[model samples]
Target: MTDHVDVLIVGAGLSGIGAAYRLQTMCKGKTYTILESRSASGGTWDLFRYPGIRSDSDMYTLSYPFKPWTHGNAIADGEDIRRYIHETAHENKIDQHIRFGHRVTRASWSSEEALWTIEATNDERPVVITASFLFLCSGYYNYDAGFTPEFPGLEDFQGEVVHPQFWTDDVDYDDKEVVVIGSGATAITLIPSMADRTKHLTMLQRSPSYIISLPQDDPIASFLRKVLPLGLAHRLTRRKNAALAIGFYVFAQRFPRLASRLLIGAARKRLPDDLDPRHLTPDYNPWDQRLCIVPNSDLFRTIRHGKASIVTDHVAQFTKTGIDLESGDHLPADLVITATGLQVVAFGQIEMDVDGEKVDPHEKYVYKGMMFSGLPNFAWCVGYTNASWTLRADLTMQYVCRLINHMDANGYAFGMPDPTGAEGESAPLLNLQSGYIKRVAGMLPQQGSNSPWTIRQNWFLDSRDSRRADLDEAMVWTVRKPVAVAG
Candidate 1:
């Protein structure tokens, strides 16, 4: 069956749900539909069912700006986040507009008609939809599989090996010796949560990551909730948390050495006095990679109590019982967890084409980090790396709404970022050094050296620009240029 709408949103996750709400409130009478690939809502939050899965960033900024997170915990668990998204969608009647089990495979835009023909499959059957505007809220990661490196002798391992992305509750690990590989946020979270149930938990890493401990319950937030109105308290806490995160990021960038020393020093104070500092000291400077946050010093407390251990060494090979280290050391385990990283996929695995020409993301330049240069009526939400993801997602949706309204006011059918006169040096989309980002850098879009084209990682700057920026100067909206007739 064929469907049509004024706006078509991809993915029913956090960003998509938020986008629906914004469109409903801001652009009234604009019919829209949300195409969700999975059978349910809450894209990433619902996908991963691993133990101890929670947000590394604080919930104050991670949650939607309109919806105040009433939950007491600043660092909320995956279940709570899922529930929040579901509640928001249901309350706003956004869930009713969602078409679950529809995985969009390809989208072709017709410049003359000024519409996008989206093709997808629902329950192995073909489905098609057309829309005037396409808002891609689908996340950047590959949902099919997480990034797992090829390990030598992995096939010979007798114990169960698992990746957190595909984890299930039935895969029992109770009273088993667990060895978690990698030192990212996922590994750190899993270590503490599994430490109690396992015979012993060992966090095996090639190197250390910068880990910080913060209180789970913010005293200021708790007090504000008691005295002030709920909405005011939520906004205040969100601003405070956003400022603290931005301040730390700016400090780290400006004074890498000093920031590194202070961060390492703080981490050292949390661990046992007799423990060697090398395990906590990262070779790289602060902010080079995302910092690992453990709410209320839970990871350190577990280590100090001898429920878990951290080992830094290179893996030589995977044995039948465990892993063999290159430095003549071996770790025996009954279950191994590879918390390696994610596989980044731009545009949610959908192939995009304009006027029958396939769009190569790497070749195209990004416009304001959301819209692709020369791509009309298309925008995707990519969050900031330095701050909370929702902070940028919220701004992105607002900007898209403004653009749509601007087009309507001007009586235009198409809007595209045409960079003709202003051109300068271009750089990679993200400035991060994480394994997942580095792996897919070549396939991602590039940003220009100047404003409107450059991808801003700062929330303060992006939020300001998203609200008041003039679109006519940067974006071109008009009738499609007629195709020249062949001689």
Candidate 2:
């Protein structure tokens, strides 16, 4: 059976839910349905079950603009975030429109019909759906598995090995010696979270990543909530946080050396005297990659209490008991955890075609950081790497709504960003130097150096420009023709 709607939204997580709410309220009477690959909502929050699974970004900015986050802790746990998304969907009655366990595999756009044909699977059975517009809210990373490098002699190790992505309940860590590999956010979070439970925990990394400490609760937000109305306080707090984040990013980019020094100095203060400061220092400057946030210096506190340690060395091989380092040192471990990284993918690895021609993302340019050039009625929701993901995602959602309303007001059948003479010197869509991003650099879309094609990561500029954007400047709009009746 085939289903059709005015709009087809992919994924039921944070961005997907937000997209639905915006569409229903702003574009009233528009028919839409959400197709989620997973059986549940809360995309990232529901999938990741590792210990210390909390958002690095503050909840105030990460939350939807329409909804006020009343949680006491600015840095929230995974379960709390999951509940928040669920509550939003329930309150807005968005849950009724979601089709769970439907994994979208292919989407084909037809300019003649001004529509899209979507192909998905529900439990190995074929399910087809059609829509006027397709919105991909699926995240960038591969959900099936995380990135883990091949370590030598892994089969020889008698102990159980685990990855944070697929952490299960049966895996025991209580009073067991554990060694977590990698130095990204996941590794840092695991080290502190598992320190107390494990007999001894050690973080083994080949290189260092910049880590910063932040308070769990925000005093300003608490005070504002007490004094002002909920809606006004939330707006003010959101703006204040956004401005502060942008200012720090600009300062770091302009003065990298000074920023690096300040970050290293702060880490040193929290770290134990015996621990080497080199372990906390990265070769690259701050903000080069996403900074790891440690709430209330939990990682440092755990290390200082002799519950955990850090090892900066290359792994030579794995033995029956533990791993041998290349620096002529062997560390004992009973359990091994690989918190390497995530496997980045474009548009949730969905195969996209326009008029039967396969769309190569690398050859295409991103229009306004959301839509693709020459692709009509399609938008992908991608967030900021330097700041909270919701900041930019909200802007994209609002802009899409505006485009839909504009098309309806006119007699336009569909609109697409014209690629002719618009492609200049292009760069990678994402501006991050992280390992995951670099791995798939040649697969994602390109961003030009000019407006509407360039992805400026500034929230202040994007928020203002989105509202006053000239929809017809680089877009090709098709006018709807009257259908003739046969005599």
Off by over 4 Å in 2: none
Angstrom error of the Cα, residue 339, model 2: value is: 0.7
Task: Report the lDDT tens digits of candidate 2 across residue range 254-345.
Answer: 99999999988898888787778789888888888988888899988998889998999999999999999999899898999999899999
Candidate 1 lDDT by residue in tens digits, 340-447: 999998888899999999988887788887888878899989988888999999988988998898888878889899845238787878878888899998899888
TM-score of 1: 0.97
The Cα error of candidate 2 at residue 120, in Å, is: 0.3
Q: Each model's RMSD to truth, in Å?
A: 3.1, 1.1
In model 1, which runs have C-alpha deviations exceeding 4 angstroms?
419-422, 480-487
Report, for all candidates in order, the number of backbone clashes.
0, 0
Give the worst 10-residue stretch by lDDT in candidate 2: 417-426
Candidate with maximal TM-score: 2
Provide TM-scores for the models. Answer: 0.97, 0.98
